[model samples]
Target chain A: MDPTEREVACFEAGIKFGTLYHQFAGTPVSPESAASLERAMEAAVENQPHCTAVDVAILVDELDTTHDYTELTGRYMEVHMRIDYGETVVRTEMRMEDGYPMMRVVDVHEE
Target chain B: MDPTEREVACFEAGIKFGTLYHQFAGTPVSPESAASLERAMEAAVENQPHCTAVDVAILVDELDTTHDYTELTGRYMEVHMRIDYGETVVRTEMRMEDGYPMMRVVDVHEE
Candidate 1:
């Protein structure tokens, strides 16, 4: 069966977010890290027809005060992302698992 | 922030699917069981604005020839559902967790 527009948007967003997470796998949340993620996301979805615009936000876990990048391992991230595909928007909460991003669909809707 | 259209659709679909699963908590898959789930789903989203129509399909695990509904406790189900909300469609895979449905958003998209 054909996937719905919402499904396509969510799937594409998942791929972009996965790439973004990989870019910061072993690094802590810093300004430069955020910029690199944004650039990676832009590049990943640039040629996609449905995804017109994309925005991603990475918020470090407040409990991670030590900036102990090495200690914050496993699938335990507090990062959230928002992707805009003009007609549809997708929001996701993701966690890192073995250096890969595993996302949960927080929301998806039309503009 | 206001949730996007896709998010709202996925959230509502989650609720409906959750209710549908609860209605068949300890029952094995049978024609009667399927009918009961369908009826429950229809009632759950009957008045929702965006969800003009909804359809669900439950495929029992092929290995579940024993029909051991009780043995299939825990979060180990092979049930999948498809929910259509005119402009959007949501597909979910669910497992029973302590007799309640725990769904994973397999896909969601616009029509």
Candidate 2:
């Protein structure tokens, strides 16, 4: 069976989430660099097709400040993305779930 | 609509590839850090469910020598990943396509 355009849209949404999570996870980040990193992440993913917007928040309060900076990880940030494909639109979010970062589809509907 | 096992496998493969690519893409890299980075990437993705093996190679020779270190990106590395979901197995690869990193499933089959 062939995948519907809806399924393709879902797959694309998953791709964006995976990309956002992986691409910046281990970067050296500190409270000072968090804002810049967040902006960079959003701009980087928005370059992808059908990605209408991206929002990234680095939890500065939770960052391990044992040193001047720490490696960025899911435990320290949250993300949201909006992807539109054909007439279908998908909204996804990522945050701590069971102490691990989980990305999931929040909503999907036809425009 | 529902996705088949193969599709789920493909989606899983995509996540690993995306994670592998994005998680490490912007790290400051010199020839010295490439090996450790590769190992960390493999270990990280391997922790994900259904991922069996991951191979990452950073092209040291391509480092932009104008500076002691450069940001990692698709132009600097190649990745291969193997994922198993139920009886379905998927192999994925990432390399430059049209001058951009492209993650694609190389094979999917049921054992």
Candidate 3:
């Protein structure tokens, strides 16, 4: 069976989450570069269809600065995304949970 | 409402695809770096839950070759991913479609 609009809305949110995480995960970062990278990541995913907004916060203090820069990963960031698919809307976010980076849906609705 | 197992499986597959595409999209690549990037990308996504395998092919011939490197993007690569979620398995691939790098599911089935 084809997916319902709600399912698709969930799928779209998932895609944004995946895209946001994967695309920026390995970028080099330091306290100096974190802000720009966050803005760039937000702008990148917002370019996708159905995405209304993307918020990224890179934890510079937690970043490993041994080499003056480190690879970005879930541990160093958190994200929020809002996606609207037709009348169905989804809000999702990713943050550290139980020592793991977890992406979870906050709400799903139709308007 | 809750997403079904199948829906969750589909969502997982989407995450892997997103991770694969985004995490490596902006990487600096040349023929010399393509092979190593491919291997590293595969290993990275495979660390995610439910992801079984990842295959990445950086189109060395298609690379810009200017400055001996270029930022990676969907146009410069092709990818295939397999994910297993309990009894549900999903197969997907990404390629250039109609001038856009499109990621699509090839099959979703239950065992």
Candidate 4:
């Protein structure tokens, strides 16, 4: 699909990067788009000079039968962003952990 | 893609029904599979008699450039299940609010 359609899919899928933990419950992404996602991650790193060497992993798990709920799942992304506050050239790794649905900013700390 | 390919895609995407939020960041899902997902939701409901009408909405949002992170995104799925503890017929709507890459169960309770 084209970018516009893809955007619509995203919109329909209701995936907001900020609130991704609440979206997709559990299912694998298609290959066609997966390639673009990897590229997007790379771009996310390249675009942000303050951020560098970002690593990400998507995780999914099945829910126990006891809860009558579908499988429980989420995603995880880690990044190394450069922090420069005017004069401070601080290099730190920012990890976007425990993402749900697509991805989310779980915790950002110096690593 | 066939079921196997689709499953593989999900696997590569690292999507587990238990933890889907950490995978996809900000981008729409392709259409071919979206239909299957909707079907899956329905099946999830049919399979679980304890669960009734499972209303789900996929939400994706763009993140501001304050921290230089990608757009904020996620998905949301709501479900209503019947509670029959041998005799108790409880009808409740379980909102699987905010699905991420594909989907993830964030919160479940009286809703």
- Choose the strongest candidate by lDDT: 3
Candidate 1 B-chain TM-score:
0.51
Q: Could you tell which candidate, 1 or 2, scores higher by DockQ?
A: 2
The Cα local distance difference test for each model comes to 0.51, 0.81, 0.84, 0.35
Q: Write candidate 2's Cα lDDT for B1-111 as tens digits.
A: 345566566556666776777666779999998899989989998999888999998889998868899999899888888888898877777788898877666666789
Worst 10 residues of 1 chain A by lDDT: A67-76
Q: Please tell me which model should have the higher lDDT, number 2 or number 4.
A: 2
Q: Report each candidate's C-alpha RMSD, comma-separated, in the order given.
A: 12.7, 4.5, 3.6, 16.2
In candidate 3, position A98 carries an lDDT of 88
Off by over 4 Å in 1: A28-77, A95-102, B1-111
**Model 2 CA lDDT for position B60:** 93
Residue pairs in collision within model 3: A22-B23, A23-B22, A23-B23, B25-B72
lDDT of 4 at B43: 61
lDDT of 2 by residue, A3-109 (tens): 45655566567678788877777899999999999999999999987889999999999999998899999999999988898998778788998998977667777
Instruction: For candidate 3, give the lDDT of residue B33.
Output: 88
Candidate 4 lDDT, tens digit per residue, B15-43?
22322233332333443334455455556
Put down candidate 3 lDDT per residue, A8-105, tens digits, no spaces: 67667877889887666778999998999999999999999899989999988999989999999899998989889899877888999888999877
Docking class of 3: acceptable
- What's the best-to-worst order under TM-score? 3, 2, 1, 4
Clashing pairs in 2: A22-B22, A22-B23, A23-B22, A23-B23
lDDT of 4 by residue, A1-111 (tens): 455533343332222232222233233344333444445554554454333334434321222333233322333333333333233334333333433232323323333
